[model samples]
Target: MIYNTLSGRIEEFKPLEEGVVKLYTCGPTVYDYAHIGNFRSYVAEDLLKRFLKFLGYRVIHVMNITDVDDKTIAGARAEGISLKGFTAKYEKAFFEDIETLRLDKADYYPKATEHVEDMIKIIQGLLEKGYAYEKEGSIYFRISSFPEYGKLSKIKKEELKAGIRIDADEYEKEDVRDFALWKAKKPGEPSWPAPFGEGRPGWHIECSAMSMKYLGPTIDIHARGVDNIFPHHENEIAQSEAYTGKQFVRYWFHVQHLIVNGEKMSKSKGNFYTLRDLLSMGFSPRAIRYLLLTTHYRKVLNFTFDALYQATASLKRITDFLFELETRNFSDGQTEEARNMIEKTKKDFTAALLDDLNISGAIAAIFEMIHWGNKAMEGEKLKKKDAEQIKLLFYDLDRVLAILPEKIIEELPDEIMELIKKREEARKNRDFATADAIRDELFKKGIILEDTKEGTRWKIIKT
Candidate 1:
């Protein structure tokens, strides 16, 4: 079951096309690097796609980069560069950041600036349908014509007085709330020619046009930040349905905002942090991903240093558990016992995900398997096959979590291997000083060693 923001109910998801999903998510504005609060939505959407693929659904994902909205133009003017040039720099950085965070690339990234013709076509269609009006060389969506304007947002048109208009893309108006679909060209700003005016698409119309261009008139799944449920997504519903007389989207999935100190994270409050900011501060990408993915998407995640530290430690424990399973001697147990445990784990994990992506529950199921593995080893009930089962279970789950470090590494340098051999000899020959010195030297070079009953193992610690 999935939570549909439009219905305000949890419903079983059945895609319009059998075994396929057309997913569209709101992308970065491209004015600057996206903050972590923005990524909270991106990462959640990434999780949704990953889980769908895990469940054997082919996903066709499209994310729209809003490169021509009010914020982008303002940023271009400040930078003194062409709008394309300015947005290009940040757009490049945005993809790099997504890769750094280990997010799966969307199948399509339709930039709004490149798709102005599509937006104009949609506006013209709305005009022909009597859903839009031309005003002062600009085109505005006549909210009164679309009687179902407030369905998604619960905003009552009756509460709004008539003869009022709002030209600003995002500014809330107290009286008139007719939003601009095509703004008139202003001095020193980018503009595109349309039948109504030579200007640009409004922020809301950009998503509608781009999403419909790629995903079609009705998207199987549409996701955004919960804060966007107001005028942004609400307007998308109005314009897209006005153009094509079908329901705009099947399911509206929204992720709640990330907060700091009980307040929404934003640049104005000096509380915003980008993915680069956290990476520069020495936090591993996997740890950051784990911390974010472990939370339920609907909950307001409180961003805190303490929580990050705990996330780091939690990931370390999973790695340590993996190491113990691989190195220890566990060759004496019944295969049926381990097989049953593995089946139960897989069942529990997938069941949690099926229930509206209950990721916290899914992860808990994984940890419970880890706990069982550790206990089985202590009781001499774990065999080599059992160990393999546990390892493979984690490998299967990592398709979604992506938290574990790879078990295999390239061969160590000859010098490093020679030193390890010498250190082993020194220990056996009662040369404690020599063994201690060799171990310290290796540690200084970022190699960490752990001795097990079977043998000694060393891993490279990225410095």
Candidate 2:
């Protein structure tokens, strides 16, 4: 069951029609590299899509890139590049980093620059309905015209005036609560011809226009970071619903911030780090994903190097166990006791994932299954069919874990293979000390060598 933040309740997720989900996620501004805090939202959304696919739903996901914004203009000016060149550079990097993190690609990645006409049409509609007005050369949405302006944020309309911050010279409006729909063309800045004038769309309006252009006036879900709840998403709700005279989104999902060392990560404070930066520091991509899944999506995740180390160790153990299981030759079938244990494990794991995507509980269930599988494998007189059933159980649980399956078959370098051979020879000669020394050498190189009843196996230790 999916939880809808708009209603503040959990409901059986029935699509607008049957068998399709229309989802939208707020994408990056493309001014710089996205830090880890930004990825928490992407990871949360990826998990949502994965779970939905596991439950047999076809999803059409759309995310927009804010290529033309205040930040993009300022960054382009600093780098002496055109706005097009600046946004393109960062957008490419964003895709590469997300691929490294193993995030599923969106069905459509719309850019703000490509949808200027759609945004102009929406603004024109608002102006015709007296919900928007032009001040000087810019267009602003009149907040007072929309009676349910604060419904999504639950902020009272009377208290919203003081929360708005507008420049006095920009306009002499009656209310300080108005937000911009379009900014008039400025000198040496990117602009295009529109019905209103020569200018560009505002940050908030771009999302509503792009989403509605691709997914219609209403969608199944709209997701963003929690920091966007107050002004950005609230403005989107106000503008879209007022223009279409219908609901904006059915479910509103937001992910909490990722804190580092008890404080929020910020670029000005020099505490910000990107996914590439973490990888250069020897953190594995799997370890990063593992650390992200340890906390719930709605809760703040406090990340530290120590926590990453623990994740690395935990992943290594699971990988080692799976590697051992795959090498054993076995046939298909199961004893009564082994079949019951596998069924119980599968039931527990599915139940945990069904309840609001409880990933932590699901991980605990995986470890329990691993424990039982190991014990079953250790029996002296195990049936071939029973051994195959145990291996299949691990594979089934991995559909959600996404950590163990990748580690089952490892690629070893020639040097590592030579060391393993040397260690094996020493062990056969009864030279225990020399064999232990060779094992330590492999550990120093981030390779773990394991000895099982089947044979010798090795895997890359996530550091």
Candidate 3:
């Protein structure tokens, strides 16, 4: 089950096509570097994709790169470059950022500039269907024509003050809320030859055009940030259904914002931190990904330096468990109790995720297994088969979590290994000061050691 923003409730997920899920996510406007708050939605969308695949569904995901919005136009103008050249630089950086955070690439990354023809076609259909009108060379979707205008966001026309709002991209519209389907060509701005008479596509119409061109008229799921629930998504529904005369989307997955220190993250607030900023602060990509994904998508993620440090520690625990399972010497036999615990953990993990993609609950189940495994390790030694089962379970869980390190890290340098050995000997010889010094030196070299009852195991901490 997953929460549907349109329905305002959690509904059982049933794809229109059997065993296939068509997901459309709103991508970023490539005007500047994407901040951590922006990635909170992207990471949640990635989790949604991975979880669906885990449930044996073939997903066709499409994300749009908004390269021609008002912000992008201004950014290009400010840089004294062509609109294409300006957006291209940020587009390249955006993809690199996604890769750095381990997000899965969408099947199609449709750009607004490339789909102007599709937007023109949809606008023409709306004009003919009497759902839209032209005013001063700009086409606008007449909100009064669509009686169910506020259904998705539960905003009522009566509550809206009668006024004129002319924002082509991101703003609230009331008093019939007629939004632009196509903007009139402006001086020194990128414009395309269209039936709408040499104008650019509006922000709301870009998704409708690109989504319909690739995913078809009706998409199975549409995921975005909660801020889009108003003018943006609301207008999308009005214009899309007006053009296609069918439901625009089945499920709407909206993620909440990422907060910094109990306030909404904003540059003006002096709380904005981009991925590069976090990385420069010595936070690992894995730890940042873990921090971004650990909370439920619907809840506000409160990000802090302390929270990031804790996430680093938590990820270390999981990595330590993996290392222990990899190197332990055990005989080939399975304890029935251990087997039962493993099976139960897998079931609980699946059940939790099935319940509205409850990832936090699923993580709890993993920790339960980890706790049991630690206790069992202290008693009767785990057989080789039992160790493999635990490892396999972790691999299965990591498929959806994706927070685990993907590779077995290479061995530390011989000097670093010797230092670790020296630290172990120092502790054995009751020389606490020497042991502490060796540990600090290794820490500076990006190696962290945990003293388990089995022995001293070290993990390479990515700075």
C-alpha RMSD values across all candidates: 2.8, 2.1, 2.7
Error of 2 at 91 (Å): 0.6
Could you give the candidate ranking by lDDT, starting with the highest?
A: 3, 1, 2
Error of 3 at 457 (Å): 3.9
lDDT of 1 by residue, 1-463 (tens): 9999999999999999999999999999999998888888888998999999999999999998989877888998998888999999999999998987788889999999899999999999998988888766678888888889989978787875565454464344222667778887888888998888788888899889988889889989999899899889999999999899899899999999889767878779988899999999988887888878878899999989888888888887788788787778767655788898899999999999999999988888888888888888888788988898788988898887777776534368999999999988998898989988998999998787766666778876631
Query: Candidate 1 — which residues are off by over 4 angstroms?
Result: 160-175, 329-334, 407-411, 429-445
Tens digits of lDDT, candidate 3, 1-463:
9999998999999999999999999999999999999999999999999999988999999999999988999998998999999999999999999999999889999999998988999999999999988877788888899999999999996676556445554243333467888888989988999876988999999999998999999989999999999989999999999888899999999999999999988889999999999988888998999998989999999999999999998888887777777877777898998899999998999999899878888889998988888777767567889989999999987888888787645578888888888989999999999999988888887777878777888877763
Question: Please, what are the lDDT tens digits per residue for candidate 2 over residues 118-199?
Answer: 9999999999999999987789999999999887788888997774667865556657788889999989889989888998
The deviation in Å at residue 37 for candidate 3 is 1.2
Among all windows of 10 consecutive residues in model 3, the one with the lowest summed lDDT is: 167-176
Candidate 1: global Cα-lDDT?
0.86
In Å, residue 341's CA in model 2 sits off its true spot by 3.0
Query: Candidates 1 and 3: which is better by lDDT?
Result: 3
Question: Number of clashes in every candidate structure?
Answer: 0, 0, 0
Write down the worst ten-residue block by lDDT for model 1.
Answer: 166-175
